[model samples]
Target: MLLALIEDSLEREGWKGVSPMEILEILEREATLRRRGSITPNDVRSVFREVKKARETPVLETLRKNLTFALPKLPVSRHKVKMEEFIAASKNMKLYSDQEKSREIMDAVYLIRPKETRQQIGGLHEIKDRILNQISLAFNPRMAELGYDSNCRFLLLGPPGTGKTLLALVAAAENNVAFIKVRGGELMSGASYHGEPERRIKELFGLARQRSPCILFLDEADAIFWGGDATSNKLLAQIKSELSELTSKDRIVVIATSNKEELIDRATRDRFEPHVYTVPPPQDDDEWNEVVEIHLQKIKPYLAPDVEGRKITRMFRRERILSPRGVAETITEAHRLWASEIAAANEVRAATDQEKRTVALARFRADLERIEHMLPAIK
Candidate 1:
């Protein structure tokens, strides 16, 4: 149990940066709370080694399968635990079980406690404000007393990598609610038996309601909601029925994203009508500069003094890196290149900060040029 707990903690996004002692402390605390007995420093060290070995060995497949099989059987005084408590514990440990039959209804959905607030998202000021308002209206307890509608739904329309998904995450983060993400493809693919797809959809909504004051984000919504076949129609109907059951008092907000809005039928689009927001690429110089700065801030220390935010923004425009995701990828690749060069140089002799910065700027420009050639020409 301690090994699994430690492994789960290490798998989480920012937890890899934590020190071994800190991880041990956390494991000790969790174990003590669960009355599973105290975890010693040596125990944590051994488990860490095992975890590393498990990752490197081919037996990782068997280990994962065993973990999945054992998760539902987690002893609770020899009695079955409530689903809500089970899921809450899973979330606390960041254990996303996509294999358990008992949890198959929620297998396609994952819960996220988003670290990105509205302030963290760059550009789309108007859209951000509107989303924030909608979240406030849906989550604020006082709004219901004042006769304001709390049933908020949003359909974020945008080109690929234009921050549509990021906006949904920010909405949940800003409201301090559970972010339940469902990829339409995964949701649809999970249904094997007849009527299973419709049943999964209904149960998904039920799970959302149970975890209320949450954001039910359906990413790439057209993948499942696009009506064509009999199964697709049934799944769509189930979603619509579940959506209708949501009243103003329910703090659950449904946010869907689609790059190709035309693929979704008019009836489905009408459900999110008047609440649809288009997330376009950064339109103005200020927006572009802000985006560049936001993405480049991580590597700012290695950037040359002359590598201004506007200069990066201009490079992005020149390279036709229109999406925020494109800009981020370019910056990340450049930084990786710069760091590798610096590391290689350090083996020979320690380099000055000025040398590092100069190398970083050079790599950034080189990457931008390479990306320019790679991107398809705009019609």
Candidate 2:
């Protein structure tokens, strides 16, 4: 009740116009008239401080908005300001010390509100369903009522460019939650001072908890958990503690991706057991066709009309462009080559649609040949 009153006053008069003493006096008067328990100035001030922090802390504000979406019953007011806007405001407010820490945390962690859905992911239908189901259970309020385990930890094992990152983004987006991505190497590198890495791990998990119904993606997990040194062991211990601390009520799902699975320790790997999934490159013609078509559609506007997508897909397959990333890069490089030619031609005369289409097809074939020798053949 006191918190509501403080919030109301702050909303009406702004934080500058409100005073803790005034709130204390109001509480004291109510207590005296009602013959209730005595109210102390310290009590009123403490509540006031909490309200002040909620309003000032940018991360809290971000989490509040996320909570408002996840749990409508919560009485958190919506803020028009974004996370970056709040950080900018904090700079002028001379809250540099706190803001600096927040900025560093943000720098190490990449926050993404993903718009990609499972449908956007070409193949991996079984993997997609499994991930979505796990995240759905984690976010479902009914699961908590039924005493179901809602917290999940996933370790995505895959080679480079196998779309592990995309899977994580899609899971968050499908669940209508925030995605916080942290590279293992980057997180460790930021820990220049003694115990800084452990501190960062705590902050990262703390932030994830605050932003419940979120996906905390740790990319390149090998880099952080691979080392056998004292620092690596300490960092690993801290991460284990954080993961173990997650309860069913916390809607945070941790997804760690690693290309070098051998580097991860046994204990660290066990933390994500029963949920570990290996994401492989496109294995069949249908998957390749779909993935190739998806990438082609993205660059369709720039391609020549006569450039056949089917031919391109076959070419990708023949050249062993197995991974989705490899296919996308091949397409992108081909487009870049064609675009450059068009730009150069514009200097003399604007190229016709026919001319552009011919050049685009040629470039696509040329890039395929170039990368055929460059790309390592899948063993």
Candidate 3:
């Protein structure tokens, strides 16, 4: 709590230096005013020293830590030549006047590697196989020459948090193709003021065409295609028409997601033909266990080292609440409680590993009760 407060204060003041003693006095005064237990001046000094040391680290080092891959082991000359060749190739591609717009659009989407293969994706194995095979067939020129449709356009209908978005990233990673993602609302918002939306949509598709053998994922697709009286909204009609045209392009696989499949217009629905897969939430005990295990693994690194996944899985199985999102939220809430416990003990900066594990487990058990209360009623 003190470190966070100090960090916030530093940011607010534009990082102009503040004396450790001055901060200690201010915190002591605040503690008195709030009738909370006071922190020792020694602890305050320790936190201030650590924060200062942290600030001395270079920003580039922090960024390097978050990178997925290390720098290539190529000679500088060869690397420079490769970069220049890539730049030249990009320039030679005649796509649009403002190609950066499409680049910006692609930048916002997350590029996931194929760590979670089709088998690792809990349930929906058959649907996963269908998607994987479709992508393979569509990308094969021989299949097209043999009179196949070769259009890999698909509509993934599912409830929220059923991994529709994850599947798109998985597909892109599986095929080693570039994944270009855009939300339906972004298109709608762009279409609102001027005719720019339609032009932008067309340009985006053109960019996708330039980068063929890529997946173009439209998230929350129903937002653009859903609603009463499409003729009443010119923006909606225009955007939908643009999407309809864009999906027909070959080698440009389009995957769209919708929570409410019924709301999508028949015309738009027709475009994503013959492969509309429904991804429902985990239902039975086995599926729920898988969901629990998947999320527990995701959050395991953030929690105490000694905290076992099996224990958490057993507890989750014992509970009545079992949404994939709900499990994640519950675990997150437990971590928050653990942080609070550390803060209460006044050893947030110097907490021992054993202390952290004990507090975290206690908090996890407590939060499960809170989560049970928060769970939605079974319909």
Candidate 1 lDDT by residue in tens digits, 157-244: 9899988988888878777776788888888785778899888787677667655667899999998778888887887888777777
Model 1: lDDT to the true structure:
0.68
- Winner of 1 and 2 under lDDT: 2
What tens-digit string does per-residue lDDT give for candidate 2 at 23-64?
544544443343322332234444445554555577656778
What is the clash count for each candidate, in the order shown?
A: 0, 0, 0
- Report residue 144 deviation for candidate 1 (angstroms): 1.2
TM-score of each prediction? 0.66, 0.67, 0.57
Name the TM-score of candidate 2. 0.67
Candidate 3 lDDT, 1-379, residue by residue in tens: 3333545545543444444335534544443343322233234444444444444344446657887777443221211111222222222222222334444344334322234456446655457677777876766667766776665788999788777877777777776665677787665553444555556566566556644557878888887666475432554566566556643235678888998888887777776778778887776656766766676676676766777656676687678455566677788778777565545434322336877756644545444344444332200
Candidate 1 displacement at residue 311 in angstroms: 0.9
Which sequence of candidate numbers ranks them by lDDT, best first? 2, 1, 3
